[model samples]
Target: MKRPYKKTDLPVWQVRKFLEPGPIVLVSSHWQGKNNIMAMGWHTVLEFSPSLLGCMITSANHSFDMVRKSGECVINIPTADMIDTIIAIGNSHGPRVNKFTRFGLTPEPAATVKAPLIRECYANIECRLADRRLVDKYNFFIFEVLKAQAATYPAYPKTVHYRGEGVFMVSGKNIAMPEKFRKGNL
Candidate 1:
Protein backbone atom coordinates (compact mmCIF):
# COMPACT_ATOMS: atom_id res chain seq x y z
CA MET A 1 0.00 0.00 0.00
CA LYS A 2 1.12 3.59 -0.64
CA ARG A 3 1.84 5.96 2.22
CA PRO A 4 -0.70 8.64 3.14
CA TYR A 5 -0.10 12.00 1.47
CA LYS A 6 0.16 15.34 3.18
CA LYS A 7 -2.20 18.22 2.37
CA THR A 8 -1.43 21.92 2.37
CA ASP A 9 -3.49 25.11 2.37
CA LEU A 10 -4.14 26.74 -0.98
CA PRO A 11 -5.66 30.03 -2.07
CA VAL A 12 -9.18 29.96 -3.52
CA TRP A 13 -8.26 31.56 -6.80
CA GLN A 14 -5.28 29.27 -7.25
CA VAL A 15 -7.46 26.17 -6.99
CA ARG A 16 -7.78 26.18 -10.78
CA LYS A 17 -4.11 25.16 -10.95
CA PHE A 18 -5.08 21.80 -9.57
CA LEU A 19 -8.54 21.40 -11.10
CA GLU A 20 -8.30 22.62 -14.68
CA PRO A 21 -10.10 20.10 -16.86
CA GLY A 22 -8.87 18.88 -20.24
CA PRO A 23 -6.36 20.58 -22.52
CA ILE A 24 -6.02 24.13 -23.75
CA VAL A 25 -7.95 24.87 -26.93
CA LEU A 26 -7.71 27.46 -29.66
CA VAL A 27 -11.02 29.26 -30.07
CA SER A 28 -11.49 30.67 -33.55
CA SER A 29 -14.13 33.29 -34.23
CA HIS A 30 -15.24 35.45 -37.12
CA TRP A 31 -17.52 38.48 -37.22
CA GLN A 32 -17.95 41.45 -39.57
CA GLY A 33 -15.33 40.09 -41.97
CA LYS A 34 -12.68 39.85 -39.25
CA ASN A 35 -11.34 36.57 -37.89
CA ASN A 36 -9.60 35.92 -34.59
CA ILE A 37 -8.11 33.11 -32.57
CA MET A 38 -7.73 32.96 -28.83
CA ALA A 39 -6.09 30.34 -26.66
CA MET A 40 -8.45 29.14 -23.96
CA GLY A 41 -7.74 26.90 -20.96
CA TRP A 42 -10.63 27.55 -18.65
CA HIS A 43 -13.15 25.17 -20.21
CA THR A 44 -15.07 22.15 -19.07
CA VAL A 45 -17.33 19.49 -20.53
CA LEU A 46 -20.80 20.21 -19.25
CA GLU A 47 -22.66 17.29 -20.80
CA PHE A 48 -22.21 14.24 -22.95
CA SER A 49 -25.46 14.47 -24.84
CA PRO A 50 -25.82 17.56 -27.02
CA SER A 51 -22.05 17.92 -26.43
CA LEU A 52 -22.10 20.97 -24.21
CA LEU A 53 -18.88 22.85 -23.44
CA GLY A 54 -18.58 25.68 -20.93
CA CYS A 55 -15.72 28.16 -21.14
CA MET A 56 -14.92 31.53 -19.67
CA ILE A 57 -13.64 34.16 -22.07
CA THR A 58 -13.12 37.47 -20.33
CA SER A 59 -14.87 40.42 -21.98
CA ALA A 60 -11.50 42.13 -22.24
CA ASN A 61 -10.27 39.50 -24.69
CA HIS A 62 -10.65 40.58 -28.29
CA SER A 63 -12.16 37.31 -29.45
CA PHE A 64 -14.93 37.50 -26.87
CA ASP A 65 -16.89 40.11 -28.79
CA MET A 66 -16.37 38.35 -32.07
CA VAL A 67 -17.63 35.07 -30.70
CA ARG A 68 -20.50 36.76 -28.93
CA LYS A 69 -21.67 38.60 -32.01
CA SER A 70 -21.24 35.65 -34.34
CA GLY A 71 -22.79 33.18 -31.89
CA GLU A 72 -20.41 30.48 -33.04
CA CYS A 73 -16.78 29.43 -32.89
CA VAL A 74 -14.51 26.51 -33.53
CA ILE A 75 -12.66 24.86 -30.68
CA ASN A 76 -9.42 23.54 -32.09
CA ILE A 77 -7.32 21.09 -30.15
CA PRO A 78 -3.63 21.50 -30.91
CA THR A 79 -1.01 18.90 -30.16
CA ALA A 80 1.89 19.50 -27.80
CA ASP A 81 4.03 20.31 -30.82
CA MET A 82 2.03 23.52 -31.39
CA ILE A 83 2.92 24.95 -27.99
CA ASP A 84 4.76 27.87 -29.55
CA THR A 85 1.84 28.75 -31.78
CA ILE A 86 -0.58 28.45 -28.86
CA ILE A 87 1.49 30.80 -26.72
CA ALA A 88 1.81 33.24 -29.59
CA ILE A 89 -1.93 33.39 -30.10
CA GLY A 90 -2.50 33.89 -26.40
CA ASN A 91 0.08 36.66 -26.11
CA SER A 92 -0.84 38.62 -29.20
CA HIS A 93 -3.85 40.90 -29.61
CA GLY A 94 -6.46 39.67 -32.07
CA PRO A 95 -7.37 43.08 -33.49
CA ARG A 96 -3.76 43.83 -34.33
CA VAL A 97 -2.90 40.53 -36.05
CA ASN A 98 -4.47 37.65 -37.88
CA LYS A 99 -3.43 34.59 -35.90
CA PHE A 100 -4.05 32.08 -38.69
CA THR A 101 -1.87 34.04 -41.08
CA ARG A 102 0.72 35.01 -38.46
CA PHE A 103 1.08 31.49 -37.12
CA GLY A 104 0.80 29.77 -40.54
CA LEU A 105 -2.26 27.83 -39.48
CA THR A 106 -4.65 26.71 -42.17
CA PRO A 107 -8.25 27.84 -41.86
CA GLU A 108 -10.66 25.36 -43.34
CA PRO A 109 -14.31 26.13 -43.93
CA ALA A 110 -16.46 24.49 -41.31
CA ALA A 111 -19.62 22.58 -42.19
CA THR A 112 -22.06 23.89 -39.60
CA VAL A 113 -20.61 27.13 -38.28
CA LYS A 114 -19.39 30.25 -40.01
CA ALA A 115 -16.13 30.22 -38.07
CA PRO A 116 -13.28 28.55 -39.90
CA LEU A 117 -11.53 25.50 -38.45
CA ILE A 118 -7.82 25.25 -37.77
CA ARG A 119 -6.65 22.50 -40.12
CA GLU A 120 -3.27 21.96 -38.50
CA CYS A 121 -4.79 21.06 -35.17
CA TYR A 122 -5.38 17.45 -34.23
CA ALA A 123 -9.13 17.95 -33.83
CA ASN A 124 -11.76 20.62 -34.29
CA ILE A 125 -15.11 21.00 -32.62
CA GLU A 126 -17.59 23.34 -34.27
CA CYS A 127 -19.81 24.91 -31.68
CA ARG A 128 -22.84 27.20 -31.51
CA LEU A 129 -23.84 29.43 -28.66
CA ALA A 130 -26.27 27.49 -26.52
CA ASP A 131 -26.64 29.64 -23.45
CA ARG A 132 -25.74 33.19 -22.31
CA ARG A 133 -27.28 33.16 -18.86
CA LEU A 134 -23.90 33.11 -17.16
CA VAL A 135 -22.02 35.31 -19.59
CA ASP A 136 -23.08 38.59 -18.03
CA LYS A 137 -21.94 37.57 -14.56
CA TYR A 138 -19.09 35.12 -15.13
CA ASN A 139 -17.96 35.67 -18.71
CA PHE A 140 -18.88 32.04 -19.18
CA PHE A 141 -20.26 30.85 -22.50
CA ILE A 142 -22.02 27.55 -22.94
CA PHE A 143 -21.64 26.05 -26.37
CA GLU A 144 -23.33 23.14 -28.05
CA VAL A 145 -21.11 21.23 -30.38
CA LEU A 146 -22.52 20.99 -33.87
CA LYS A 147 -19.80 18.89 -35.44
CA ALA A 148 -16.46 17.32 -34.57
CA GLN A 149 -13.61 15.87 -36.61
CA ALA A 150 -10.24 14.41 -35.73
CA ALA A 151 -7.24 12.52 -37.09
CA THR A 152 -7.63 8.76 -37.04
CA TYR A 153 -4.07 7.51 -37.11
CA PRO A 154 -2.99 8.59 -33.65
CA ALA A 155 -5.51 7.30 -31.12
CA TYR A 156 -4.66 10.16 -28.79
CA PRO A 157 -2.90 13.43 -29.43
CA LYS A 158 -0.28 14.86 -27.08
CA THR A 159 -2.39 17.63 -25.54
CA VAL A 160 -1.22 20.40 -23.22
CA HIS A 161 -2.92 21.31 -19.96
CA TYR A 162 -2.31 24.53 -18.04
CA ARG A 163 -1.43 24.50 -14.35
CA GLY A 164 -1.37 28.28 -13.94
CA GLU A 165 1.65 30.42 -12.90
CA GLY A 166 3.20 29.80 -16.34
CA VAL A 167 3.30 26.03 -15.86
CA PHE A 168 1.95 23.44 -18.31
CA MET A 169 1.54 19.68 -18.28
CA VAL A 170 1.77 17.63 -21.43
CA SER A 171 -0.24 14.51 -21.99
CA GLY A 172 1.73 11.35 -21.31
CA LYS A 173 1.20 7.67 -21.94
CA ASN A 174 -2.41 6.59 -21.75
CA ILE A 175 -3.60 3.50 -19.97
CA ALA A 176 -6.68 1.65 -21.11
CA MET A 177 -8.54 0.05 -18.25
CA PRO A 178 -11.59 -1.25 -20.06
CA GLU A 179 -11.72 -4.26 -17.81
CA LYS A 180 -12.02 -2.02 -14.79
CA PHE A 181 -15.11 -0.27 -16.12
CA ARG A 182 -18.63 -1.57 -16.26
CA LYS A 183 -20.53 -2.02 -19.50
CA GLY A 184 -21.16 1.24 -21.40
CA ASN A 185 -18.78 3.02 -19.03
CA LEU A 186 -15.65 2.90 -21.12
Candidate 2:
Protein backbone atom coordinates (compact mmCIF):
# COMPACT_ATOMS: atom_id res chain seq x y z
CA MET A 1 0.00 0.00 0.00
CA LYS A 2 1.18 3.47 -0.83
CA ARG A 3 0.86 6.45 1.49
CA PRO A 4 -1.72 9.04 0.40
CA TYR A 5 0.14 12.27 1.12
CA LYS A 6 3.64 13.27 0.08
CA LYS A 7 6.21 14.03 2.79
CA THR A 8 6.85 17.67 3.63
CA ASP A 9 9.39 19.50 5.72
CA LEU A 10 8.44 19.43 9.39
CA PRO A 11 9.29 22.43 11.52
CA VAL A 12 11.19 21.98 14.75
CA TRP A 13 8.65 23.94 16.80
CA GLN A 14 5.77 21.75 15.64
CA VAL A 15 7.49 18.54 16.79
CA ARG A 16 5.42 18.39 19.94
CA LYS A 17 2.12 19.07 18.17
CA PHE A 18 1.41 15.39 17.67
CA LEU A 19 2.25 14.58 21.29
CA GLU A 20 0.40 17.53 22.79
CA PRO A 21 -3.05 15.99 22.88
CA GLY A 22 -2.86 15.18 26.58
CA PRO A 23 -4.96 16.13 29.58
CA ILE A 24 -3.99 19.36 31.29
CA VAL A 25 -2.99 18.96 34.93
CA LEU A 26 -2.10 21.38 37.66
CA VAL A 27 1.15 20.68 39.46
CA SER A 28 1.39 22.00 43.03
CA SER A 29 4.57 22.19 45.05
CA HIS A 30 5.93 23.77 48.19
CA TRP A 31 9.38 25.16 48.96
CA GLN A 32 10.75 27.45 51.66
CA GLY A 33 7.41 28.82 52.90
CA LYS A 34 5.47 29.18 49.70
CA ASN A 35 2.95 26.96 47.95
CA ASN A 36 2.95 27.31 44.17
CA ILE A 37 0.94 25.80 41.37
CA MET A 38 1.42 25.52 37.61
CA ALA A 39 -0.69 24.16 34.80
CA MET A 40 1.11 21.30 33.07
CA GLY A 41 0.45 19.31 29.92
CA TRP A 42 3.79 17.70 29.05
CA HIS A 43 3.68 14.55 31.13
CA THR A 44 3.53 10.85 30.41
CA VAL A 45 3.50 7.54 32.19
CA LEU A 46 6.77 5.73 32.66
CA GLU A 47 5.27 2.70 34.38
CA PHE A 48 1.84 1.45 35.36
CA SER A 49 2.45 -1.40 37.81
CA PRO A 50 4.37 0.74 40.27
CA SER A 51 2.93 3.98 38.82
CA LEU A 52 5.91 6.04 37.73
CA LEU A 53 5.37 9.28 35.78
CA GLY A 54 7.63 11.61 33.85
CA CYS A 55 7.09 15.37 33.52
CA MET A 56 8.83 18.29 31.90
CA ILE A 57 8.86 21.68 33.59
CA THR A 58 10.56 24.44 31.73
CA SER A 59 13.22 26.40 33.59
CA ALA A 60 11.22 29.62 33.27
CA ASN A 61 8.15 28.35 35.14
CA HIS A 62 7.74 29.42 38.75
CA SER A 63 6.86 25.93 39.95
CA PHE A 64 10.09 24.59 38.45
CA ASP A 65 12.26 26.17 41.11
CA MET A 66 9.99 25.11 43.96
CA VAL A 67 9.58 21.54 42.74
CA ARG A 68 13.32 21.33 42.18
CA LYS A 69 14.08 22.51 45.69
CA SER A 70 11.43 20.47 47.53
CA GLY A 71 11.62 17.35 45.36
CA GLU A 72 7.89 16.74 45.79
CA CYS A 73 4.66 17.74 44.07
CA VAL A 74 1.00 16.94 43.54
CA ILE A 75 -0.50 16.34 40.11
CA ASN A 76 -4.11 17.53 40.17
CA ILE A 77 -6.34 16.57 37.28
CA PRO A 78 -9.33 18.82 36.66
CA THR A 79 -12.55 18.22 34.78
CA ALA A 80 -13.50 19.87 31.49
CA ASP A 81 -15.70 22.31 33.38
CA MET A 82 -12.60 23.95 34.73
CA ILE A 83 -11.04 24.71 31.39
CA ASP A 84 -11.38 28.47 31.81
CA THR A 85 -9.83 28.30 35.28
CA ILE A 86 -6.98 26.21 33.96
CA ILE A 87 -6.25 28.80 31.29
CA ALA A 88 -6.30 31.55 33.89
CA ILE A 89 -3.93 29.59 36.09
CA GLY A 90 -1.57 29.00 33.21
CA ASN A 91 -1.61 32.64 32.15
CA SER A 92 -0.97 34.24 35.51
CA HIS A 93 2.46 34.36 37.13
CA GLY A 94 2.54 32.21 40.22
CA PRO A 95 4.95 34.39 42.17
CA ARG A 96 2.72 37.45 42.02
CA VAL A 97 -0.65 35.77 41.90
CA ASN A 98 -2.11 33.84 44.79
CA LYS A 99 -3.91 31.27 42.67
CA PHE A 100 -5.62 29.49 45.51
CA THR A 101 -7.16 32.67 46.89
CA ARG A 102 -7.58 34.45 43.58
CA PHE A 103 -9.26 31.55 41.88
CA GLY A 104 -11.27 30.48 44.94
CA LEU A 105 -9.49 27.14 44.94
CA THR A 106 -9.56 25.07 48.07
CA PRO A 107 -6.33 23.55 49.27
CA GLU A 108 -6.20 20.43 51.38
CA PRO A 109 -3.13 18.92 53.00
CA ALA A 110 -1.65 16.03 51.12
CA ALA A 111 -1.11 12.70 52.89
CA THR A 112 2.47 12.11 51.69
CA VAL A 113 3.84 15.48 50.61
CA LYS A 114 3.92 19.09 51.71
CA ALA A 115 2.21 20.13 48.51
CA PRO A 116 -1.48 20.85 48.91
CA LEU A 117 -4.17 18.84 47.12
CA ILE A 118 -6.77 20.80 45.23
CA ARG A 119 -10.15 19.76 46.56
CA GLU A 120 -11.98 20.61 43.34
CA CYS A 121 -9.91 18.29 41.20
CA TYR A 122 -11.16 14.94 40.01
CA ALA A 123 -7.90 13.23 41.02
CA ASN A 124 -4.76 14.14 42.87
CA ILE A 125 -1.56 12.14 42.72
CA GLU A 126 1.12 12.82 45.29
CA CYS A 127 4.61 12.42 43.93
CA ARG A 128 8.24 12.57 44.93
CA LEU A 129 11.22 13.08 42.68
CA ALA A 130 12.65 9.72 41.61
CA ASP A 131 15.47 10.93 39.38
CA ARG A 132 17.03 14.25 38.44
CA ARG A 133 19.73 13.16 36.04
CA LEU A 134 18.04 14.67 32.94
CA VAL A 135 16.72 17.85 34.51
CA ASP A 136 19.73 19.93 33.64
CA LYS A 137 19.89 18.83 30.04
CA TYR A 138 16.21 18.39 29.25
CA ASN A 139 14.29 19.90 32.14
CA PHE A 140 12.67 16.53 32.71
CA PHE A 141 11.90 14.94 36.06
CA ILE A 142 10.91 11.39 36.93
CA PHE A 143 8.39 11.08 39.73
CA GLU A 144 7.22 8.17 41.83
CA VAL A 145 3.65 8.24 43.05
CA LEU A 146 3.39 8.20 46.81
CA LYS A 147 -0.37 8.49 47.16
CA ALA A 148 -3.48 9.11 45.10
CA GLN A 149 -7.07 10.33 45.58
CA ALA A 150 -10.07 10.49 43.30
CA ALA A 151 -13.75 11.37 43.38
CA THR A 152 -16.33 8.59 43.48
CA TYR A 153 -19.42 9.74 41.61
CA PRO A 154 -19.41 10.73 37.94
CA ALA A 155 -16.76 8.11 37.31
CA TYR A 156 -16.00 9.33 33.82
CA PRO A 157 -15.97 13.08 34.16
CA LYS A 158 -15.07 14.99 31.01
CA THR A 159 -11.36 15.77 30.96
CA VAL A 160 -9.87 18.58 28.87
CA HIS A 161 -6.89 17.93 26.64
CA TYR A 162 -4.64 20.56 25.10
CA ARG A 163 -4.10 20.46 21.32
CA GLY A 164 -1.73 23.42 21.12
CA GLU A 165 -2.34 26.99 19.87
CA GLY A 166 -5.10 27.90 22.34
CA VAL A 167 -7.19 24.90 21.34
CA PHE A 168 -8.50 21.97 23.40
CA MET A 169 -10.48 18.76 23.16
CA VAL A 170 -12.76 17.18 25.73
CA SER A 171 -13.18 13.52 26.56
CA GLY A 172 -16.47 12.15 25.34
CA LYS A 173 -18.42 8.91 25.84
CA ASN A 174 -17.18 5.93 27.82
CA ILE A 175 -16.78 2.50 26.30
CA ALA A 176 -16.08 -0.86 27.80
CA MET A 177 -14.04 -3.58 26.11
CA PRO A 178 -14.21 -7.20 27.18
CA GLU A 179 -10.82 -8.79 26.66
CA LYS A 180 -8.43 -11.27 28.17
CA PHE A 181 -6.38 -9.79 30.99
CA ARG A 182 -4.69 -10.49 34.29
CA LYS A 183 -7.03 -10.80 37.28
CA GLY A 184 -5.19 -8.35 39.49
CA ASN A 185 -4.40 -5.71 36.92
CA LEU A 186 -5.67 -2.98 39.20
Q: Highest lDDT among the candidates is held by which one?
A: 1
Candidate 1 clashes between residue pairs 3 or more apart in a chain or in different chains: none
The runs of at least 3 residues in candidate 1 whose Cα sits more than 4 Å from the true structure, single-residue gaps closed, are none
RMSD (Å) of each candidate, 1 decimal: 1.1, 2.5
Q: Could you give candidate 2's per-residue lDDT for residues 1-186 as a string of tens digits? A: 977987789887876767785789999888887888889999999998678999999999989899988999999999999998999999988889889988889989999999999999999999999999988899999999999989997888789888788988898987675455566653
Task: Report clash pairs, candidate 2.
Answer: none
lDDT of each: 0.93, 0.90
Q: By summed lDDT, which 10 consecutive residues of candidate 2 come out lowest? A: 177-186
lDDT (tens digit, per residue) of candidate 1 on 85-166: 9999999999899888999999999999989999999999999999989988999999999999999969988999998888
Give residue 177's error in model 1 in angstroms. Answer: 1.1
Backbone clashes per model, in order? 0, 0
